[model samples]
Target: MTVTTPSIAVADPVFPGRWVGGASLVLGPLLLLTGVLLRLPFDFFFPAQLNAHQHHPDLMTVSYSFASAGWVLLWPGVVLLAARIGERFRELALWGGALTVLGLFARTFHAGVDHLAFQLVAVRGAESATRTVSETYGAFHVFSTLNAAIMGGWLLLAIGAYRSRILGPVRAVGLALASAMPLGVLKGTTPLSVVAAAGLCLALVPLGVAAVRSGPNPRAAAVAGRLLLLIAAGTAMFLFGQAG
Candidate 1:
């Protein structure tokens, strides 16, 4: 008689919150890249001439629209990242997520006023209208408050991630450093700013890949497909608009 040995069972890896986290990872860089492409061609510190504005209204519009859309991905990414760090860091995650969401919402208002309203006014050659719109929308940014919340929130989230060891040291540090990107933008476009943006994009890649590799779930897969399609459609529209 021969004796048989029992086999050990290996459990499948399931990342509880990877659904939103994964989507955010996949979409976040797409949003960032689109925004950078839109901005890099222009002088962030100076106003465009009316003639220039008229000639490239579609480009401006597409860039602004896509950039604004980026936030839709970004806010969720922030929250899901916090969630991935688990319950031990719950307090930090909660505060960070709330503040980040608030800051992102404020930023959307800024984008609306600047890209949609201001662009319209600029195209029409109304200097007064542009100024009024700028000032009115500017009130919401209150740089100090908005910037602080965004930066602080990310910092806290990064710290939580580091402590939880979910993203490990390198990725956690990268995320923390990315939080400073807003400050770079505030200083106007420079070589350093471009470098910072590129670095942030690189840092986000691993997070996105991890989310994708966390194995497939029906709901997450569907959401990911929709986001991919949305990006593709938006890109196509922008290209078509530019060509026309």
Candidate 2:
């Protein structure tokens, strides 16, 4: 007798896994939006020119502000990858989840540091400004480095999925774009930020739409729930960014 593993192609039709992918697709963008808007205050409102000591426009605060949102964007990719290769590369999912959490941690601390840096710059003198610059840059460097690793993990997962034909080519491209995002900091411009922030963000929309139309599956229902959550969260984040 011989033992054989089940195929993931159309014959097997892993419906449950598809549901997982759908849910992630729906929720990921919403999370990204929420995180993005929270950090917009540092980017859009705070004028760097006001301070002669301003070195880099509080890059940490700005990047992590968007990073908070980046965490949300990662949900779908994480879920999709988990659904596909988790059984074989269980470590991938575990590491990917860890990376997401780590990214969030970095973002949270970075935000806190930004808060302190801002006050230091505002109330204190050039010495404080120097500290603020160093602190902000330090935080950004950490966050960017960690996030790049996370994106690299996702890209690896995406490559696995693409090779398996589980995620299709477009999704693979999106994952590749996502993997390239952390490098945006190297460019350090608004357009670069936009690419990093919202570029791959649209990749999951198709999955969301598919979930809504999927009909009568636990996975589809889950995806629908996530999609609604994302819409609400994204809206809130957007408003928060506008007001800030």
Off by over 4 Å in 2: 1-24, 30-67, 70-73, 87-105, 119-130, 135-148, 183-190, 211-244
Instruction: Give candidates' CA RMSD values in order.
Output: 8.8, 8.7
Q: Judge candidate 1 at residue 106 and give its lDDT.
A: 62
Model-by-model lDDT, in order?
Answer: 0.59, 0.51
Error of 1 at 178 (Å): 3.2
TM-score of each: 0.68, 0.52
lDDT of 1 by residue, 1-244 (tens): 5332111111222432565566676676677656656656666542452223455767766665666676556775666666655456778888877877776776675565555554565556546544554565345445446767766776777787677666556656666765665441212244544554455455555665666565645687887998899899999999999999
Residue pairs with backbone overlap in model 2: 19-219, 23-223, 31-72, 32-72, 35-68, 35-69, 36-69
Clashing pairs counted in every model: 0, 7
**Taking the tens digit of each residue's C-alpha lDDT, what string does model 2 give over 166-216?**
456766566556555433221223434455445445555555455444555
Model 1: weakest 10-residue lDDT segment is: 4-13
